[model samples]
Target chain A: MDYFLELLIGGLTRGSIYALIALGYTMVYGIIELINFAHGEIYMIGAFTALIVAGVLAMSGMSGLSVLILASVVAVIYSAAYGFTVEKVAYKPLRHASRLSPLISAIGMSIFLQNYVLVAQTSDFLPFPNLLPDLPFLANYVGFIGSTEFIIIGTTAVIMVLLTLLIKFTRMGKAMRATAQDRNMAMLVGVNVNRVISNTFIIGSALAAIGGVLIASHVGRINFYIGFLAGIKAFTAAVLGGIGSIPGAVLGALVLGCTESFATGYVSSDYEDVFAFVLLIVILIIKPSGLLGHKPTQKV
Target chain B: MSTLNYTKYMEGMKQAVVVSLWFMFLTFPIMVIRVNTIENIIEWRWMNMLYIGAGSFILSFVWRKMSGRGISARKESIGAQGGRKFYLQRLVSEKRLSLPALGIVAVIALFFPFVSSIYQTNIMTTALMYVVLGLGLNIVVGQAGLLNLGYVAFYAAGAYTYALLYHHFGVGFWLALPLGALAATVLGVLLALPVLRLQGDYLAIVTLGFGEITRLVLENWNEFSYGPSGISGIPRPGLFGMEMDMHEATVYLYFLMILLCIITIFVVNRLQDSRIGRALLALREDEIACQAMGINKTMVKLTAFALGSTWAGLVGVIFAAKTTFVNPASFTFLESAMILSIVVLGGTGSIIGIIIGALLLILLPEYLRAFGDYRMLLFGIIMVIMMIFRPQGIVTGVRKTYEFHTEEK
Candidate 1:
């Protein structure tokens, strides 16, 4: 029972991070219908930015909590900037082109960003400073739930609620939904489609950045290549939940996280990634529309 | 008029400055600052900011000019009758020029091994392998419009099949070659069975997942795949049971690749004009319309997948023979990307374009050692720029058009 509880908490923590990244993918896909392949790169850049900020602040003798706050803020800003730039440079021009054009461009942008980081920063993995300080209240639950895991889950829950409100009640959110439903109709109805798309990228990127900071602090390591695998897994989570659906992305992420956690825990860790991919393949084969995604009718 | 021109120039310069400033800000943390967390030290490379500022300033100007020209050129092309033919396309279409060009190329290829060092011969062999791989992928992505991101999985399948066959049963290259391709074909069919219903991005991600699964399984399955330590010491291809030295073997492999490349080109060219070829093209353009026209979508997609994998499988065997080694590392997503870039850069459906793309991409990095690190960066940039400016590629594929004339009696 104790082991089960531990695995459950671990899965939730993992699921929260995946949810953060998956939101970006799902939202982008909802609006533009492109996979936004560079999104993982955005998450990676976010982590790197936080690492840099945290490292500098730590060296200057700032306290842990303050450093974490400042680092997270800067990471969010930088990631949002990058996400906006990537869409503008890569996707905006190819909007009128064939379906494959934007996808290829997105892939190109992903590669470019990865190489950009590799060239600019050292390719070796850097140690991410543990910015999450230990909470005295959580000391009794150390075995089953660490302070980092507690905070991660807490922060994620708060963010998810905030995101839900933003989407459900906000004007920009309404604009985003309108654009996603039909770009031309939204334009006719006086919604600035481009602005909505850009805002979606920004919001999604900000969420991913928060996820990046949390995961980096939790894992204690950072690398340029971290984004590729994480991105794929998050994408799987999104697909599992049914892409283009918000709550579905969260549910899918949690399910995927739990599955990975249990699979790796009971079985061997060697096939952890394989389990995720296999699950993805299985889900895709069984339910192409995803758990919550509606079946898209083909138009002539 | 001079005042107006000066004002325009000044406006452009102002925009360039803003663009450069934005770039400098964007690149500040990553490019200009390096923080050592363990050592608690900060290295601020202020010079990088200057470089980025200058680079972006110049690049923005170039970007504006190019885009301006692109819009006008597109308008002109649209206005022109019958559209403007690419020079390379014309060169290929005219037999008078193409035959001699082909003869010259053939002569150069035949004499290349003798004149060049063994190192150059090996490099050329690698380039030729890419040519075949590019052409093969062109069939699926170019003609059929199905993006198979896991194309390297089949390559890995072919390689591992040969490696395992040789490892377990002492199978020779001659036997393993056909067997490896056959194994890859079977895997392709199997993969296609599940993924045939998927289209576009969904298909891409599923294939990508499939690829990752294959690699992970290979990496973990120690007893079977040697668990990433890799299988080495595979023998090279043989000729009439004769033993050859290193240089002789290199030459042999080079010639073998050339022969295989020719055969692949021939088959792909013939396939492109065949009924199935037209079907693949139609599928790429419009899947629903094609099915509505009575074409079997499943069989066509399956054929494209199978045919494409066959070439990858063939090359995988050759790759194992050439390196005398087999490892999961050799068959990576990057390899698939490189091949896809070759197809995209060369012109998706254009054979001549792919050949040029392969040679330029593979050989340029080797020859230009100083820019080796930037090769992939350039490739990414090229892909984006090509898609934006000229999606048709360097050599556009010419479509066959028919004309009818009534008999005047």
Candidate 2:
């Protein structure tokens, strides 16, 4: 029972990170019907930004929650700027072309970013020691599950709450919803579509970066290619959650994380990939719109 | 004859001269450089000889036709002679005969053992393997309009299947090959089950995830797959009953590779004209229309996934046999991209076109061996330029029509 609980917690933590990234994919896809293939790379850039800011903070010798808070602010701002720039440069120009053009371009940007980082940082994995603790309270149950699980799940819950509040209650949130529903109507009604997209990129990227930091902190190591798979998982999470649906993304992330963790833990780990991919493909075939998404009927 | 007929004769003649000249040049260098063993120059050898022979045959035909010409301008001759026939003859321009030209090439390929060095043969073998990969992807991206971003997953699955079976179970390549294909097909079906509901961008993302997820699992799963160290020393393909290690028979092996290439070419060509291909194209153009017209889009999609993946799996088995190694790195996104590029550049849905595409794309970089680090930069620039100039591709609508006419015939 304790082991199961641990696995569940572990799953939730990973799911949280996935949920954050999934939100970006789902939102961009929801509005423009284009998969922002570069989204994962943006998450990558954010994680690196966090690394830099955290390094600066530690070097300056700031201590306690203040250090964490200050580092967090800088990381978020940096990642948001990075995300906005990525969209502006890669996506905005090809908006009028067929949907496939933007997708191809996004993939191109993704490849470019990965190679750029690999060239700049080298292809080796770097160790990132604990900027955040695993916390002792989780230790008593560590035998049952693990410390990483607690930190991830806890951070995720806090972030989710904040995100929910931001999306549901805020004026900007209302405007964002208005924009997603109908871009033309939103524009005519004086809601800035481009601004909303920029804002969406910022929020989504910040969440992914935070998730990235958590992942780095949990694992204590990362490489330039870190976001490649993680980004895909988060995208899966968004799809699982029914994309455009915020709660759905979180739900989807949790499911994917749990399913993968359990599969690794119990089933043949060698075929873990075979299982997850096959599962995703199966789900898409069965429910094309996704579990959380409503299918739109086509007009003749 | 009318003006058009006269022009045609003239154009045919010009092509004949040009083709024969090209063929002569191909052989002229050979005759001049016959000092060292024929294998000395690395690049010029039996392949060039075959090119010259084929070129000569085509050139002779053109020469014969042009000899009949009264007057000619290049453009007018092309119009008179028939553009397709001119291009076809012009393309070979060596032997000046179709069946005999082919026969000469075959005889040369057979005698390659007596001539060329081993390195050129190895490159030919590699190019043939890629021809299969290119054709498989064309089925998915070209026929079905489904963007399969993670095709390498199937390739890996196929390779690993061969390695595990042949190494551990003591299965022969023949048996292991089909089994690997089956496993990939099953996996393809399984993958299709989820993402079939998704279309366009959503489908692309899901497929991409599927690809990465497969690779990640393989990477992290240390025990069975040996983790990152990878599975090595897999078995090689064999002669009918003889072992490949018995002799330094590069030419015989090259012959076998050519046989496989021919079989692949034939199979893809047949599939391209079948009812299934038509259904796939219908789905590509308009999914709703296909559905309304009584096509079961689900089944068609699954068939695409299964067949396309099956080919990849088969190619994977061949790859495993050739390399004697299987690992996660070999089946990366770049492999998928290369295959996708081949399909796109070949003009999608074109069987022979993809062959040319694969041969050119893969061999182009090989020939530019001097460029080294700058190769990728140049390759990328070329791709961008190709897209800008000939986005419809080199072989676009030809195959579709070819399939129909063959059926009619």
Candidate 3:
């Protein structure tokens, strides 16, 4: 039971990070129908930004809650900028080109971003300062669950709830939904589809930034290449959840997280990535529309 | 007239501004770095960033003048004008300089090893391998219009097949080459079978996943693969019964590559006119219409996958033999991207185009090695710029005209 609980907690915490990143993927995919391959790089940049911020703050003799909030805010802003630029420069031009062109362009952008970071930052892994505050009183109640785990879960829940509310109620969300449903119809309805797309990129990137900060702090290290694997895994999570569905992304991420956790715990960790991919293939084979996605209505 | 000229200048200025802003955003992250000096100072090159922006703006202005229209206009002209003389085709058809050009190229290939240093010959050898890989990928991406993002998987499959066969089963390189290619083809067919229903982006993702899975399997199957340390000391393919030095070996490989290239081009060109090829072309244009016309979609797609993977596998064996090593690291997503870029950059479906594309993409980075770390950075940037500026590729493939077949019809 203890082992199971530990696995479950670990899975949930990891799942929350994947869920945050997956939401960015699902949202962008939902709106533009382009896999923003550079989004992973965006998360990576966010972590780097936070690392820089935390380093600067620490040198100035600041730490704990204030430093975390400030670093996260800066990281979010930087990531949002990157997201906006990537969409405009890379994706927007090829929106109507052959299907493969945008994808190729996205991959190019991803490579460019990766190399950009490699040139700018050290290739070696740099330790990230743990920003989660330790509160001793809650230790008894939440036994094996670390403060970092709680923070990650809490942050994800709060963000997911807020995002749900925004999507369900806000005008921007309505415009996004409308644009996603049909770009032409959305245009007719006077939704600035370009603006909506840009906003989607910004919001999605900000969310991914949060994931980056949390995962970096949790792992206690950051590197230039962390984004690539995490991005692929999160993308798998998004696809497993049904690419365009938000709730499905979260659900898929949790499932992916648990599977990865169990695979690592029971089986050899080397095969963990293989298990996720196999799961993806099996799911895609069985349900092409994914667990929550609707069967796409084909028009003659 | 004066006002119009002024308006044009203003428009050009506006474009420059926009381009400058774009560059600023793009290079923001790259221009700043944390130097690990005594104080850990943040290195931010404001002047360098601004200069790059200005340089890009000026380059765009120059490009606008050279191209003689807006960028969109260039794209429209290509789409609208189908009969524009493709240089290679026109030269060959006109029977003027093309045959001699071909002779010169062949002569150059024949004598290149002796004239250039061993290092240069080695580079050309690697470039030739890419040429073969590029041609194979062109059949799938260019001919069939299928986006395969995991092409390196087949390459890996081929490489590993040869390596395993040699290491365990004691197969000769000559015999193993065909078997390795066959293995890749089989794997390709198997991969396509599972995702038969997928289309477009979904198909792309599935292939990407499969590629990652293959890599992971290779890496993790330590009992077989030797786990990341990689298998080394595989015997090099011999020429006749001679034990050759490095230079002779490279030259031998070059000639072999040329023969393989000739075979691939001849077969692909012949296939281009075949019933199956036309069916594939039809499928690429419209899957539904092709299916309605009684074409077997699954069979056509599977054949495409098979043919493409076969070439990749052949090259894989060649690569493994040349390097005498095999590892999962060599077969990353980036390798697939490089191959795809070659196909896309060289006009898709064009044989000569693939040659040029493979040469430029492969050799450009080698030549740019002087730039050190910026070589790959430039590669990525060039790829994006190429896609944006020339989606049709450097040598836009001439649309096929079925002269002989049409006469019979």
Q: Pick the candidate with the highest TM-score.
A: 1
Model 1 lDDT, residue A292, Cα: 92
iRMS, all models = 1.5, 15.4, 2.1
- List model 3 lDDT by residue over B103-122, tens digit each: 99999998898899988988
lDDT (Cα, tens digit) per residue for candidate 3, span A1-300: 989889999999989999999999999999878887888999999999888877777776887899999999988988988899888877887777776677778888998888888876778888888887886866988798888888998999999999999999999999989998999999998999999999999999999999999999899988888999899889999999899999999998999999989989988888989989888889989999777877787654
Pick the winner on DockQ between candidates 2 and 3.
Answer: 3
lDDT of 1 by residue, A1-300 (tens): 988888889899999999999999999999989888899999999999999988888788887689999999999999999999899888987788767678778878888888889888978999988888888777775656889999999999999999999999999999999999999999999999999999999999999999999999999998998998888899999999999999999999998998899898999898988899898889888988788998888888
Best lDDT among the predictions, by candidate number = 1
Q: Candidate 3: misplaced stretches above 4 Å?
A: B1-30, B33-72, B75-80, B83-97, B402-409
Name the runs in model 2 displaced over 4 angstroms: A1-4, A60-70, A133-155, A165-175, A184-192, A261-288, B1-124, B168-235, B239-270, B332-334, B345-347, B350-409
Least lDDT summed over 10 consecutive residues: which range in candidate 2 chain B? B30-39
Report how far off residue B340 is in candidate 2 (Å).
Answer: 3.0
| Candidate 1 residue runs with Cα over 4 Å from true position | A140-143, B81-83, B406-409
Which candidate has the top score in DockQ? 1
Question: CA shift at A34, candidate 3, in angstroms?
Answer: 1.5
Ranking by DockQ: 1, 3, 2
Each model's lDDT? 0.90, 0.72, 0.86
